[model samples]
Target: MDIFERKPVNHAIHTSPSNDLRLVESAIPDIQPHECLIHVRATGICGSDVHFWKHGHIGDMVVTGDNGLGHESAGVVLKVGADVTKFKPGDRVALECGIPCSKPTCYFCRTGQYNACPDVVFFSTPPHHGTLRRYHAHPEAWLHHLPDNLSFEEGSLLEPLTVALAGIDRSGLRLADPIVICGAGPIGLVTLLAANAAGAEPIVITDLDEGRLAKAKELVPRVRPVKAALGEDAKGFAGRIVSELGQEAKLVMECTGVEASIHAGIYSARFGGSVFVIGVGKDMLTFPFMHLSSREIDLRFQYRYHDIYPKSISVAAAGLVDLKPLVSHRFQLEDGIKAFETASNPASKAIKVQIVDE
Candidate 1:
C-alpha cells in the first residue's frame, strides 16, 4: 500500500453507551486549510479509555453515542492542507490531543495554560472523537515532529510523559529532593522517570501490586519501592513510606485516585511540603483537611498537560528516559477490543498496552 494513498475505508475503534467496544469502518477524514491528515501508526490505551469502555462515561461526560477511544497516538503525515507549512507527507509526528480555543481574550489560552481552557476539545473525552481511527485530521500547530531516535511507540508515550513533566513542574521539584510517589501505574512510573531525570534522589514509590513495585525498582535501581499492606490503614501506610525513606517526603506525587492513597500521600509529606494529585478520582473526595492545613502542606491538582510536548520529545530523544521498558503488551489495531480487555485486567500485569498499525 502506498503511504500517501488514502484507504477507501477507515477502521476505527469506538466505545458505545452500551458499554461495549466495536471496530467500525468509516470514511477517511479530510484536512482543513491549516490541518494535516495523518495515518495513525500507534495509539496507547489509557485508563480513561478503559473507564469509558466499561462504564460508558467518565464523571458527567456521558457517551450518548459511539465515541472513538484513544488519545496518546503517533502517526505519519499522509497529506497536508494548503495552509499547512511546517510538515509534509511522510513526516512522523505525535498528536497532542487537546485543541483549545486560541482566542486572544481567552484567559487560559493567552496565559499559556491552554489545558485549562473552558472550551478545549480533548480527544477520547465524551462528546469529542479521538485518534483511534486509521486517519485523523489535526491542526499542524498541535502536532510535534518525532525525532529519528524515537519510535512511533515512544512518540505515543509522550502524552503521558507530558503529564509527568507537568506534575514535576507544578511540584517545584529540585535536585536531590526526597520525594514520594503514590501508585506505580503508568502515570506514576512515568513521573518516576521524569523525577530521576530532574535529579531527584532517594525516591520512594508505593503501590498495592508487588509486581508493579518490582518493575518500578527495576526501572530505577536507586528507587525505594514500598508495597502497601493489605487492610492497612492510610496512617499505617504513610508510616511505612516514612520508614522506607527514613524521613517524611518533601513532595508527594499522588498518582492513584484511591482515597486511601490520597490520604497516605497527605500524611507522608513533611511539614510545609506539597502533595500534588495527578489522578482522576471521584467527583467528591473527603480528605484530612485539618491535618494538611495544620502542617501547611499545599494540596495541588493537575489536569491534562499544557505545553510540555517539546520537552517530552527532547527527553525521549536524548535517552534520558527509556519508554520501551514501560510497554508490557502490544496488539494490532484490529484487536483493539482485546487490547482494552487485557489492559483492564489486573491479572494481565500490563503496564502500558499499545495498538500498532503494520
Candidate 2:
C-alpha cells in the first residue's frame, strides 16, 4: 500500500435491534482522490442504532447481512483526494454521513438538500456500510471542518443537531412562541437547545425516561423537562401545560416518533399552530386528523435536513450552541461492542454516546 493510501482497517461492528451487537474485523477502507481519509476520533449511538440493534431493522432499512453501525462521528484527516480542497492531512473534523448516490441531478441535491436527496448514500444502513471503525474514507465535500474549541464528541453530534435545527426552523418559531417537544432523548434535547437559542418561550419536553429528562433539565434550567411517567395523568398533564403555558403551543416539535407522542403534539398545539416532525416512529399510526384539520394545524414532516449543514456548522463554530451537555457517554475504538451495547439500552446512562479513537 502507498504511504498516503487510506487503507481499510481490521475492525468493524454489526448489529440488529433484537440481537446484541458484535464487533467484527473487516476491511478498513480506501480513499479515492476526490475523497478524504478520516481517522475517526468519535462516533455517536443514535436512536436509529438502537432500533437496528433491537429489531434487526428500522422500517425498510434492515441488517440482514454484513454492515457497520454508526453515523454521527468526528475524526482526523489522514489523507486527501488528489483534487480535494478545503481540507488537508491532520485537520481534525466531523463526517457528514449522507453522500450523493449515483444520481447527482436530484432536485434535493440541485437545491443543496443533499440530506433529502434520494440519490444520496448514507452510513450504517442496509446496502451501505457505516463509520463504526477506526478509519473511513469518504468524499471531501462531506467532511466538516471542526472548530478547535469543540471536542470530537460534540463535532460528531453535529448531524443530529443539524436535524434538530432543521425541524425547529421548519416550525418558524418566533421569539415568543411556545414549544412542546415530545421525547427527551438526544434528538429531543438537541431540539430543546435549538429552540432555546431561538428564544422560543418555555420549551416543554415529555418523555417516559427519568434519566433522560433529568439530564435535559441539567443542561437548560429554562427547559421544562417533564417525565410522562407511568400512571401519570395525560389529560391532567395537558391541562397543566395549558394552565402554565397560558395557551396552546404555537409550535410543537415531535422528537419521538411514537404514536402517543404524535398525538400529544397534535393536541398540544394551539389551533392553527405548526408542528414540525423529525421523529421516526412505526410506519403508520391512528391520528386525530379531523381535529387537527379542524384546527387548521400545519403538521409538517421534516425528512433528514435540507441545505442546513453550513448554517449548523456556523452556529457551532461561532459558539452559539453549547453541545457539551448532550454527549453523556463515549468509548474508544477497541471498546466498540460495549459502545453499541450501551447505546442499545434506553435505560443506559447516556443521552448521546460516542466512540473515540485511542
Candidate 3:
C-alpha cells in the first residue's frame, strides 16, 4: 500500500477569536525538496498553547486569526521529498519546531546559535502555523530520528527536554553541584530529571502548588520540594530554599517566569553564582538591580534550544531520563479542546497534556 497515493483528511486544532478552541479541517501541507511530509502521531500541549487559547495572545504576540496550536510534537514520515537523503517513509521521527536560515552570512547561525537567528521560523509563534494536525511538512534537517525504545509520546517530549538540557548547559552545572530550580511545572520537573541524571546533589524544586511539588518528588525521589507560601516575599522564599538545601545554591534555574520567582532565584544563589531564566513571562519586569549587582550574580536567559535535540533523544533512548512520568493527561486529537481546558485548569493537576493521533 502506497501511503502517499491518496492524501488523508487533515484536522487541526486552532484558537478562535471568541477565546475558544476549534478543530478545523486544513489542507495537507506540500513538501519542499528538502522537506518531508509527517503523519503527526503525538503533540504535547505547551503552557503557551493554553495561554493563547484563553487570552488570545502571549505577551506581544497576538493570535490574529484561527491560528493552529502545538509545537512539541513527534510523528512518522509518510513521504520524503526528492532531495531529502536522511529520512524515508515509515521512519519514526521527532520534529524540531524551529527552522533557521543556515546562511553563512548570518552570524548567529554561523556561530552554532541558530536559535538566535533573526530569520528563524519557529512554529506556533504568532503568524506561523503549528503542528497540531494529522499531517505537516517539515525540513529534513530539523526532523530527528526517534530510537525504537522511545514511543511517539516520548518522542514528542524531546522538544521540552531540549529546553531542560539547554538550561543545564547554559548554567555550567557540574557533578554533585547543589542547585535550586523554581517552579514544578513540566519544564522544571524535566530540569530536575536532567539535573539528577547529571549527578547534581541535593536538588531543590519550588512551587506554590503542593500537588506539583509532590509530583516532582515522585518523579525524582531524591529531589527536595519546597512549597512557597501565599504571601511569601522573594527574600523570605529564598531563605526557605537555602534552609532546605542547607546552604545557598551556586546555580538556580528559574523555570517559572513569575517576577517573584525570578527574584527568589537570584536571592537563593550564593555570591557570584548564576541564575538562568528559562520561562516566558511579562515583557517588562522589575528586578533587584542593586542586590544583583552587589552580589555579582550572573543572570542569563535561555532562548529556544539549538543543536540539542539529538542529545535529548539519546538521553531518552538510553533511559537516563524517563519522559513518560511527565505526561499527566492524554487525549485524542478530536478532544484537543478538552485537552487545552485540562492544561489551563490548575485543579486538573496536569503536568503535561498530550494529544495523540492513534
Candidate 4:
C-alpha cells in the first residue's frame, strides 16, 4: 500500500425502496492482484438506470437498498494492485460494464461469447453495485486506457457506443446500405454515427420526439429524419418510413424497445432484409411473427456487447464520430437527486445526463 494513500472513504449514489436516490459514504475497496481502484470522474445515466429508478426494476434486476445505480463510467486510476502491469496510478480509463466468468470450462467464455456467460455479473444490476461513486475497484482486464484525445465524458460513452457497433455488426450491414433506425435516444444516435462510419448512406432515423430527431439531424445533416405522429401504429410508421425513403430500407436497427417501434422496424425492412433489435423493453410484445416467414425478414436480437471496448475507444480517438453532442446535461456528485429528476423528465430535453465528480 502507498504510504500516502488517500483516506479510504468513498461516497456512492444508490436508490432507496421509495424510488429516490441518496448518497452515502462507505469504505473504499481494496484492490485484488488483478484489479485497480479508480477515482470515478464521469458516468452517464442510461435508460435502464431510469427504469430502475422509476420502477425499481428492469427485467429481473431489482434495485434494493444496497443497489448502487450507474454503469456507464470513466475515471482516473488511483491505485493498481501488485502484479498488475496493464495500468497504474494517474492513467485515465473507461470501464466495460459486464464482468464474465473467467473459468475456461464455461461454455460462453470458451466460445468467445463471454457476454452471454450465464454467470456474468453486470454493474448496477440487482445484486451488483455500479460505478456511480467517488471510487471503484475493477478488474484491470475490463478497463481500457483512454487516450488523451477523448474526454472522460466521451470515455463513459464507450459502453453505449459498443451497443451501437454490436447492432451494426449483427446486421452484417454492407457499405451504402439503406437503413432505418428507430428511436433517437442515445443508442439510436450512436447507431447513426456507427452507420456513417460504416459508409451507410441516406439513412432514415425515426423518433416520436421531434426535438430528438432535430438533434439527430443537427449531428448528421445527411440523415433523413422522420417524426412519428402520436398514436401512430407500427404499420402506419412503416408506411411513413417507406414514403420518406422511397423504398423499404435494407436494414432497420430498432434502438427503442417500445413494442410499436419494434413492429415498425420489422414491418419497414425490405423483403429478405434484416432487423436488429438493440433496446431492452417489456418481456412480452404482441407481434406478427408469421409475417417474418413470408418476407424472409431476419429478426436478430443483441445483448450488451462482447470484446468491443478497444474498437470503440479507437473510433472515438480517431475522431470518426463525435459523441459530445449527446451529453446535454451534467450534474455534480452532490446533486444526485436532482440529476435523476432531470434525467427522468422528458420535458428537460435531456439526451444524456452525466454525473461528474469535481
Best by TM-score: 1
lDDT of 4: 0.89
Please report how far candidate 2 places residue 12 from its true position, in Å. Answer: 1.8
lDDT of 2: 0.79
lDDT: which is higher, 3 or 4? 3
Off by over 4 Å in 3: 1-7, 16-18
lDDT by residue for model 1 (24-124), tens: 99778878999999999999999999889888876787899989999999999989999999999999999999999989999999999899898999988
> 1-358 in candidate 3: lDDT tens per residue?
5544554678899886678788888998888999999999999999888888888787777888778889999999988999999999999999999999999999999999999998888888767889998899999999999999999999999989999999898889999898999999999999999999999998999999999999998989989999988768889999999999999999999998999999999999999999999998988999999989999999999988888998999999999999999998999998888888899888998999999996
Q: State the RMSD for candidate 1.
A: 1.2
Better of 2 and 4 by lDDT: 4
Error of 1 at 21 (Å): 0.8
Task: Give the distance in Å from residue 311's predicted Cα in candidate 4 to where it truly belongs.
Answer: 0.8
Worst 10 residues of 4 by lDDT: 1-10
What TM-score should be assigned to candidate 3? 0.97
TM-score for candidate 4, residues paired by index: 0.96
